[model samples]
Target: MSVSATHAAGPPAGGPPPSGRRNYARSYWLFAAPAAVVVAAVMVFPWLFTLYMSVHDWKVSGATPFVGLANYAKMLSDDRFLWAIIRTLIFTAGAVIAPVILGVWAAVTFAGNFLGRGIARTVFVLPMMATPVAISLVWTMMFHPQLGVLNYLLSLVGLPPFGWVYDTTTVIPTLVMVETWQWTPLVMLIVLGGIASLPQDPYEAAVLDGATPWQRFWHITLPLAWPFVVVAAAIRMIDALKTFDTIYVITLGGPGTASETLNILLYQTAFAYYDLGYGSAMVVVFFVIILVITLLMLGYRQKGIVT
Candidate 1:
C-alpha cells in the first residue's frame, strides 16, 4: 500500500488504528506508576519532611520555629557528635576490611571441591540469614561480664572475664567482630560467584608454567577478582556505616556513647532527647557522609572494572 493511501485509510476495519505513542505512554505509566508512588511515599516524603525539620527548631513539646542552619552549626561544637563521627569511621573501616579479607579466603576455600562442601557452605551463611536484632540479642548474652558463655570459656583457660559491650574500649571491637561474622558470608557469596565465572585459561597457563597455588592466587586470582572485591567492599562499607540495629539492641549507645555511630547519635537526638531539628540536621549530615563515601567507592569500582 502506498504511504499516503495507508495514512488516508485511517482506522482499521475492526477497530481504531493502533496508536504507538499512546500505547507506549499508557504502558510506561502502567509500569512506572506503582514504583513512582512507592518511592514518593516511602522515600521522597520522609526525606522532604526531614529537610523541613532540619530547618526548624522542632522540639517534642515546644513550638517549631524556623532556625535555618543553626542546628547544623551546633554539630561543630558538640564533642559527643565529634566522637560519634570518629567511632563510626573506626567501625566502618574495621567492618569493611576484616570481612573483605576473610570473605576472599572463605570464597577461595569453598570454591574447591570437597566432601559435604555444599552443606558446609550452607552452615557458613546461616549468620547472614539471621535478623540483626536476633543476632544482637544472642551476642548480648555471650558478651555478659561474668555470666556469659564467653566468660565461662575464659575461666576454663585461666583467664579473666572481660566486659565486651560493657567496657568502652572493647565495645566497638566486639561489635566489629559480630558485624564481620554475620556479613562475611555475603562478601564470600559475591566473590565466589565472580570466582566461578572467571576464565580458566590464565590459571591453566600459570599451572603449565609451574606456578604454585600461592603464586597463582597472588598473580591471577586477586587481579581477576578485583572488581568483585570492590563491589563487596563498597557494599560492606555502606552497610557498616549505617549500623544501628545491632548497636541499639546490644548497648543502646551505651558504655557512654563508646559505640555510638552517626546512626545511633541521630536516633538519640530525635527520639531519646526529642530534639527533632538537631536530629534531622544530623540525619542530613550522616547522609552526606555516606553519599561521599559511596561516590568514592564507585569511582574506585569504575577504575577497577576498567583496568
Candidate 2:
C-alpha cells in the first residue's frame, strides 16, 4: 500500500503540520498570557495611571480634573523640589565615587596573594548582606552627638566631638559614609572579576620594562578594568538616587529637610500630603532623570567597548 501525496509531503520544513503548529502557537500564547496580564496589571497600568495623574489635579478626596502641564510647571519654580534634585545629585555622586575608589583599591589589594584573604573578603562583604533598615538603625545610634562611639573615638584622637547626622553640613557626608561602607564590596567584586579575566601579557611586559607598581596600575589595570568600574558606578548611581529605606529609617529628612532627596520629597508629597498629581509629576521627572543617566552611562560603556 502506498501513502497519499499530502501524507508523503509530511509536516512543513520548519516545524509540525499546519494544524499542529497552530496548536503549538496556541499553547505558547496560553502559557505566556498570565505573565503578560500580570505585567500589564502591575507595570503598564500603574505607569499609565501615573502619567494620567501627572497631567491632572488629582488629590486624595477632591475632584481629579485634567490640568495639562500645570503640575510639572509647578516643579520648575518650587524651591524645595529644586533643592531636592541638587541634594539627590550630591548624594548620588558621593555614593558612586566613594565606593568606586575604595572598591577598586580593595580589589587590587585582595587580588594579590595574602594570608587569610578569604576571611577578610568575607568580613568586608558582610555589610552588603545586611538589610538597609537594620544598618540604618545601628548607624543612627552610632551617629549620636555626645554618647556615640564614633564621637568617643574622635575624642581619643584629641579631636572635637562632631555631629554625624544632626548638623546640616555633616548629614549628607554621614549618609554617604554609611552608603560607601555597605556598597564598596559590590564594586570590589565586579572589578575583581574584570581584573581576573584580564590578559597577563601586558603586566608581564610592563614588569620586564621595570614599570613601577603605580605605573603598571595606571597603564594597564585601570584601562582594562574601567568598563567594570562604569558598570558598578551605574548600579550605585541608581541605587543611591532611589535610596529610601536607610535615609527614611535614619533621618526621615529631618534637620529642617536638609536631607530631603527627591525620593523623600516624593513620598511626602504623594502619601503624607495626599497631593497625588504633583507627586505623579515628580515621579515622571525622577524617571526621566534616571533614564537619562542610565543611557549616558551605557553609551559611555559601549563606546569604551568599541574602542
Candidate 3:
C-alpha cells in the first residue's frame, strides 16, 4: 500500500503488459487479414488488371498485345464515344438538378406537421426501394407508344401519343425522369435530416419580423441547410454518371446512340463487342472523370463545413 511497494507492483491488476499489447495488435491484424485479402482480390487486383488491359489490345480471344494509349486515342476519334460523353453529361445534369430541386421541395413540404405524414413519406420513398431493373421494366411497359397507360391518359386529355424512350430526341430525358423519380426521395431524406437539425431560433426571429414563408426559407432555411443539399447533389451526380441498369433495360441506348452514356457504351464495347481493351480504356477515363468531380464536390463540402 506504500508508494514504493505500489511502484514495485508494476501496474494495476487489469493493466496490459507490453507482451499483451503486442498480442492484441497481432490479434487485430489477424482478424483483419481476411478482409484485407478480399479487398485486394476484388478491388485492387481488378483495378491493376484493368489498367494493364487498357494499355493492351485484349479481345478475350486472340493475342493480348500491348498497344500503349492506342485504345485511348481510338476513343477520342470515335464519334460514338464523343456522343456518349455528351449524352452522359446531359443525362447527369438532368438527373442531378431535377432530383435536387424536387427533393428540396419535398423535404420542405414534409417537414411540417401534417395528417398521414408517415404514410405519405413511406409512399414517396417506395420508388427508391424498388429494384432499378424491375422499375425499368414497369416503366418500359408504361412507355409503350400506343398501348401504354401514359399514352392512354394523354389521349383522354386530347394529347397525341408520344414516344418516350423510342425516340432518340426524348430517350435521355425520359431516362432522367426515371432517375429523378427513384432518387428524389433519397435527397429528401438527407435534406430533411439537415432541416430537422437546424436551430429554431432563426425561424422564430424571422416569423416575429413578419417574414413570409418564401422569405424565411430563402433567407434562413436554405442557407443553413445548403451543405446538406450539396452533399445530396454530390451523391446524385456520382450515381447519375454511372447509371446503367435502367438505361439498358429501358432503351439499350437505342433509336441510335442518342441515349448512350459512357456507361452504356463501355458495356457495349466490353461485353457486347468483346473489346475488353477498349472497354478498359473507357473505364479508366470514366474513373478519372468521377474522381475529379468527386474531389471538387468534396472540397466544396469541406469549405462549406468550415465556413
Candidate 4:
C-alpha cells in the first residue's frame, strides 16, 4: 500500500505497534495528576486566597471592603513591619551562620575514626529529633537569669549572671543561640552524609604529597564539600526565616519586640490584631521575601564555583 493509503487504514491484524514514548506519557499523567491536583488544592488555593485577601480591608468581623492596594501601601509606613524585616534578616543570618559553622566542624570531627565517634554521632543528632516546642521550653528555663543552670555556671567562673531571652539587649542573640543549638545537628547530619559519600582518593593523594590535616580540608575537602555546605545552608535559612515556635514559646517576640521576626509579627497581626487584610499583605510580603531568597540561593548555586 502507498504511505497515504496505509496511514488512512487502521492498524494490521491485532493493533498498532506500541510506542514507548506514548506509553510513558500516559503513565506520567496517571501518577503526576493526583500529585498536581493535591498541590493545587493545598498550596495554590491558599496562595490565591491570600492574594485576594491582601487587596481588601477585612477584619475578623466587618464588611469586607476592597481597598485596592491600600493594605500593601500601609506597609511602607509601618515601622513595626519594617523593624520585623530587619530583625528577620538578623535572625536568618545568625541562625544560618552558627549552625553551618558548627555543623561542618562536627561533621569533620565525626568523619575521623576517633574514639566515641559513633556514640558522638548519635548524641549529636538527638537534638534534631526532639520536638521544637519541647526544645524551646527547655531553653526558656535555661535562660532565666537567676534560676537557670546557665547563669549558675557563670557564677562558678566569677562572671555575672546574664539575662538570656528576657533582656531586650540580648533577646535576639539568645534566641539565635537556642535555635543554633537545636538545629545545628540537622546540618551536621546532612554534611555527614555528604562527607561519607566523598571519594577517598583525593585525601590519599593529598597525604602522599605531605599535605597537613588543615591543608587537606582547606584544599581537597572544602572544594568537594562546598555543594553539600550550600545545601545545608539553604535548608537552614528557610527554616530560620519561618521560625515562630521557639520565639513564641520563649519570649513571645519580646522584651518589647526585640525578637520579633516577620513570622511572629505576621502571626500577631493576623490573629491577635485581627487585621486580616493587612495580615494577608504581610503574609504575601513574607512569602515574597522567602521566594526571593530561595531564587537567589538557587541561582547562585547554578553558578558553578570552587569545584
Candidate 5:
C-alpha cells in the first residue's frame, strides 16, 4: 500500500506518535517539578538575593540604596582585600598540592598487601572524618607559641620552638598544615580506590617485560590513576579555596589580619564593619573565582580524558 493510504487506514508507522513525545515530556515535568521547586527555593533564591545585595549600599541596620558598581570599585583598591586574595591563593595552592602528593604516596604504599592494613587505613582516615571545629581547637592548642606539644617536640629535637599561628610569617603555612593533616586522608581514599579498581593485567604484563616497579608505576599505574587524582585534587582545591571554619576558630583572622582569606574578609566586612553591600561584592568576586577554578579543573579533566 502507498504510505498515505496506510496512514489513512491505520495509526502512523513511526516507533511512537508525536503524541508520545508530549506524554513523555509531561511525565518528565511531573517528576522534575518537585526538585525544581526545591532547588529554586534553596539555592536559586539565596543566590539572587546575594546578587541583588551586591549592587546596593546595604548597611546592617540601615536601608539599602542602589550604588551601581561602587562596592566593586572600592574592593579593587582595598589593600587588605588584595592581601586577602593573595593569602587565599597561597593557602589554597598549598592545601591542595601538599595533601594530594602526600596522600597519593601514602595510598600507593598502603595499597600493598601488608599486615594490619585495614587498621592503618582506618587510623589515617580518622582525621578526615573528625569535626572541623574540634580539630581546629585541638590544633590551636598544639600550635600555641610556648607550651604546645609541637613546641615541646621541637625542644626534644634541640631546635627552637617556632611560633606557628602567632607568627605573621608562619600563620598561612600553619593553617595549610592543619588543613592538610585533616584532608590528606580524603585524597588517599580516592587514590586507593582508584588503585584498587585498576586492572592488574597491565602491571603483570609490564613485569613480564622486565619492567622495574618504578618503571611500571611511572608508565602504567600513574596514567591509570590520573582520573581519580584529578577528581580528588579538584574537590580538595574547591574546599581549600572556601575554607573558613578552621581558620576562623584558630586565628580569627588575627595577628594583623595575616591569615584573612576571602571568606574571613567577607565575614569581617559584613558583620564587623556592617558593610553588607561591600561584603556581598566580595562574595560575588569569590564566587567568580570559584567558578573560574572549577571550570578550569573540569576542562583539564575533560582534556585529559579525551587524550
Candidate 6:
C-alpha cells in the first residue's frame, strides 16, 4: 500500500513558477515612489494651486474670494493683454525665422572641411554660453545712443546713429536681434547633427546623376534634414514665446510698452500689481497657448516620421 500510493508528490516542475505580475508591479511602484512624490510636490501641486487661485479673486493685500471666471473675463477685455498677445506672436515669428535661416546656413558651412572651423564654431557659440543677464548688459552698452560701439560703427559707415531700445519702433526688433545672436547656435548644433547623420547613398546617387553641390543639397540634404529643421524651429519658437530676461534687462518691456509680450504682462499682473488671481488667469492662458503649440509641433513630428 505504501509503495503503490506513496510515490512522493514531487515539487512542480521548473523549480517554482515565476513571480506574478502583481509582484513586479509592486517593485516598479517601489522604484518610482520617490520620483512620483517629487513630481507631485513640485509640479502637480503648484499647477493645481494655480488653477484654484485663478478661479478666485486674490489680492496681495487682501483675502481671496471666489470670483468664478471674473479674472478670465477681465483679461479677455483688457486691451493691453490683447496687445501682449499680438506682440508675442510677432516676436515668436521673428525669433524663429531669423535664427533658423542663419543657423542652418552656418551649420552647412561648418559641415564642410575648412580651416579654423573649431575656432569659428566656438566664436559662434560664445553668445549662447554667456549668461543672459551679462549678454543683455553688454548689448545695452553697445546700444547706448552716444558712446556705444554700434553707433560709432554706424557713424564710420556714414549712417545716422540710432537709439535702438529707446525708440518705440526699433525696440522689438533690437530685442529680436539679441535673441537671435544668443540662440542661433542651438539651431546650428541641431542641424549639424542631423546633417552629419545623413546617409551618403542619396548624395552619391545625385552626384552620379551629374547634380551639382547646390542641386544635391536642395534635392537630398534638405528633405532628409527637414525633420530636424522643424524640431529646431519649434524649440526656438517656444523659447522666444517665453523670453523675459533679455527683454527685461534691455527694454523692461518699455519704449511705451511696445515690447510687452504675454510673459511680461503676466509678470506685471502678478508682481507689479500684486494681483495673484488675475496673474494666475494669465498664466493659465499662456500655458494653454504653449500646450497648443507643443501639440502642433508633435503633430508635425509625427507626420515627418510617417512620411
Q: Which tens-of-lDDT digit does each residue in 117-216 have in candidate 1?
A: 9999999999999999999999999998867999999999999888889999899999999999999999999999999999999999999999999999
Q: What is the C-alpha RMSD of each candidate to the true structure, in Å?
A: 3.6, 2.3, 3.0, 3.8, 2.8, 3.8
What's the lDDT of the predicted structure labeled candidate 4? 0.90
What is the C-alpha lDDT profile of model 4 across 178-229, one tens digit per residue? 8898999999888888888999999999899999999999898777887888
Deviation (Å) of 240 in candidate 1: 0.7
Cα lDDT of model 5 by residue, 110-221, tens digit: 9998999989989999998889999999998998877799999999989998979999999999999999999999999999999999999999899899999789878998
Quote the positional error of residue 259 for candidate 1 in Å.
1.2
For residues 13-106, could you state the per-residue lDDT of candidate 6 as single tens digits?
A: 7665346766887899999999999999999999999999999988988789999999999977899999999999998899999999998888
lDDT, candidate 2, 1-307, per-residue tens: 3568777778678774578778998999999999999999999999999999999999999699999999999998999999999999999999999999999999989888899999999999999999999999999999888878999999999999897899999999999999999999999999999999999999999999999999999999999999999998899889998999888888999788999999999999999999999999999999999999999999999999999
Per-candidate TM-scores read 0.92, 0.94, 0.93, 0.90, 0.93, 0.92
Query: What's the residue-level lDDT of 292 in candidate 1?
Result: 98
Candidate 3 lDDT: 0.94
The alpha-carbon lDDT assigned to residue 69 of candidate 4 equals 92
lDDT of each: 0.94, 0.94, 0.94, 0.90, 0.93, 0.91
Pairs that collide, model 5: none
Model 2: lDDT equals 0.94
**TM-score (C-alpha, index-matched) for candidate 2:** 0.94
Error of 1 at 220 (Å): 0.6
lDDT of 3 by residue, 1-307 (tens): 8999987878778786767688999999999999999999999999999999999999979899999999999987899999899899999999999999999999999999899999999999999999999999999999999888999999999999888898888888889999999999999999999999999999999999999999999999999999999999999999999899999999888978888889999999999999999999999999999999999999999999898
CA shift of 254, model 4, Å: 0.7
